[model samples]
Target: MSGSQMGGAGWEKLRADIQKSQFVLVGEDHGIAQIPLFTAAVAREFKPAIFVAEVDPYVAQAVAQLVAQPGPATAYLRRYPEALCFFDWSEEFELVRTLRAQQVQLLGLDQVFITTSAPFYAQLAGLVKGKVAKSYFQRQANKYQAQNQAFEKAGNDDFAMAKQPQSAIDSLGLLTQQEGPAAQKMAHDYALSYTIYQKQAHQLRVNLMKQNLVQALLPYQTATGPAAPKMLFKFGSNHLARGLSQSVKGEFYDIGNVVQNLADIQGQKSLHLYIIGKQGERAESDNPNFPAKRVGTYTVAENPELLPFLSQVAGPAWSAFDLRPLRRALTTSKLQLANPSLERTILG
Candidate 1:
């Protein structure tokens, strides 16, 4: 309650590192209210030119437009409750509004959500020429509506896009061929994402995300190969680790590692922080319709190196542990630790 969103030496240390780092990445657990609060504080301090989000590219575009005017966003959510994924949370909405107000570029680089198909199709419909094509897009939009509704009611893939007929998919692909470049790109990404989901292709999904990050930054690059705009990436912990992701058993280098390499090319550093609740009741289910059914305790300080930071988590305030020094200690062999695996987790 007293610090910079929870003040003390730890917060000061983290802020100092943030001041100097070109990229500040926050890997967080979903369904925590304090996360948005703390992240907003980081936004103010970092003043990043770009804010990378966890949602899909089109959804990010929608969020940027919706948050520009607060009242319409609320109304739109009421009608299409799951139109946006992570930002559907009230706290996340406020955080996006904060970033929008600061004039930060919001970039979403992930797979499209099932419930957002209707809105995405509507966007595609608006971009194309001619009445017949427009009508076709509208019909697809309606199908998406029906599919989403059925999936929500039964919570099954039986009614999902993955099960759609091959002919239907071919028709859409053919329609996109007739559309403009912008519409074509959207359809291509969506189709690739659909295939990934259908096959449960985790590596392909990660590769797509890396490609999206490159595509999002292309405009800023030139013949001279200048650095990308200063950015703050907010994603799940698994997606933001430096080298190997625990989720993938050390097989994949995710978006966080991608950003790190980019920063290294520019002779700058990317700061990655993993944030979670000290202890609290968390949402049992991501769906808003699912009632809060249980209380849980979450913490990331079980390791001895993290114990100092744990003590800084005072009532109603958060804590920040600057892992850079600990990371340095490991690389330089300043601290004697016998376990190699524990060293990697701490370094991460």
Candidate 2:
């Protein structure tokens, strides 16, 4: 993708696009320290009434409570380390602080119950608990050990012959035709394992939806005006897909499915979804696919609107913004937009 310049006019256009929308989804590339700055900038421009984060409600509630108290915002970081996993502390703190100052309600969209253990245990129970699940896990361990031993032997032979690090050679060997069958077998086994894990994750996601719906409805239930103009949902692209689908094979549910289910239960069609993703990286087959198009690039001169905001936060000196990095960011933002196909399914 070519790096194009976005000027003040471009920023205004982007702001206009955001203002006209009822929902804005911002997808991100890899979890980099700078990504949150862009998120905050966009949020500042749009000023959505609600900011939905990937963090679970339990953590969000705790953080929200902490924000309500008067002190350095960084103080809350020490209390909840896991919440920092999604974004850098300083950027996230700034975003949270700014949002709170503006009185924008923060909503937690992730399910609280979907722990790593839940899926493993659920699968274990399905496989017959102590008898089948334990045996399966043990067998899996043994198989991995054998593979590791073989890989080590191959690495040793390559290193001995070439007198260099065997990492690249080892990686190449693993991707060769000889390894294809083994890779397929591993994939199949992973699928089976994932099936068990997904059941538990799905259950947790459903529970989260129930809780979020109740919370979001409270204000509307009490009174009614035109209703909030827009909502901004910030989350991993995976959950925003057509349903609450995990990357685990058959276990994935596209966000679309979740929305349809919600509409069926609520008897409402007022919600609008905007899926967003950033560009810069090539799309991986495993990643959630979306109807994506280039939305231009972010250049230092073009987005001068961001200059003041970026300056306020500490970061690397701003130079010419590379188109590749900006594209990657935009591609991610596009993916966050709710899938239109899923939306159609629900509305129809």
Candidate 3:
């Protein structure tokens, strides 16, 4: 009902909603530091018949193989080239380890549409093929001018106050609007080339959905009487919507979109959706209003059980590995789960 209650009370309601509905889709804000913990909590609470993540299917398959055959977390981390910069495998690996320990079914939801090289080539080809489309060029030019005007306006407003000049914002605006036409032409050409890629992506997406659904539903399909009441799908927020918000009708087709499309294709009409976003300076007010409850915003705390394992690996270096040492200290000293009251309430 309120922002504070969104994490705990809202999550409890979400679990309940998932239990009674045919499907539940949880969307997440990107790089939300709290998401790993939130996801781990949801998996534990609902013990959802199935769990999925934003990981690509190929990567997922690798993860599945690794999950099935337990090994060092480092081995698993090596598989993802994209994760090297910020994500240490330990954070997510711990969740995978926990889920496997709990015997939860995990699925990866990303489907690759085109090989990375081909799309780059196609985009380059499109840019060289013609005089940049006139309309596209004009739109880009107008966007550049408008952005410049906006920066000047913001600067003027800030200057009215007796504050130090906000050169950073002004500088960033300059950087963003520089090379207006060439940038626009490149972007438009890339988009034009991407149209071909999108068709392939869509087809791959459909196939991946069909495959995942078949596997997820296999248990129920083989069972007699009324099947299990519900399922929880964990995927990137990107996959939850239809597509980028800019495209016409493209706004409607993500994993949630895929689910709806599947339901329509199969003539079913009853599934529920639940999405989660991280709390930030922008505030929840900036988020889109979907027809679901707002769960509370939470920050991730290290799972206590994980520390001993980490300690074993890092040895004398354990302190370095434990980023939130206070949380870890509280967890270890208290000999308690973090936020037990909230956890119990949600699990209940």
Q: What RMSD value applies to candidate 3?
A: 18.3
Top TM-score prediction, candidate number = 1
Q: Write the per-residue lDDT of candidate 3 for residues 154-236, one digit (tens) a residue.
A: 43211111121345223223432434564454443334224434444554454456565655555655333224334556554
Residues 1-348, candidate 2: write the lDDT tens digits: 011223355456566666665556554433434545666776776777888777655446555766677764443332221233243244565667678888888776555322212222223233432354345444533443343334333432111112213352243233332434533333233333244334555655545554564566566542433243356666654455434342434455544345445444444332223222222232221111111411223334432334433345334322222133333544566423244433222222
Candidate 2 yields a Cα-based lDDT of 0.44
Highest lDDT model number: 1
Tens digits of per-residue lDDT, candidate 1, 1-348, equal 332264667788888888999999999877777778888888888999999988898889888888888554666655454677878776787788888889998998898775676777778889888677788888887787776666555534333466666676566678878778888887787787777777888889899899999988888887867579889999988788787763525577899889989988778989888986666755444344334332345655433444545666677655555666788997898987665545555677
User: What RMSD value applies to candidate 1?
Assistant: 3.4
TM-score of each: 0.86, 0.44, 0.42
Local distance difference test, candidate 3: 0.41
- Each prediction's Cα lDDT score? 0.75, 0.44, 0.41
Alpha-carbon RMSD to native, per candidate: 3.4, 16.1, 18.3
TM-score, prediction 2: 0.44
Candidate 3 C-alpha error for residue 324, in Å: 37
Q: Which portions of model 2 miss their true places by more than 4 Å? A: 1-12, 68-80, 83-88, 113-200, 221-229, 242-248, 251-348
- The C-alpha stretches of model 1 lying farther than 4 A from their native spots are 1-4, 150-159, 248-250, 284-286, 292-317, 332-342
The per-prediction tally of clashing pairs is 3, 41, 9
In angstroms, how far off is 33's CA in candidate 1? 1.0
After TM-score superposition, the amount by which residue 160's alpha carbon in candidate 3 deviates from its true location, in angstroms, is 52
Poorest 10 consecutive residues by lDDT, candidate 1: 286-295
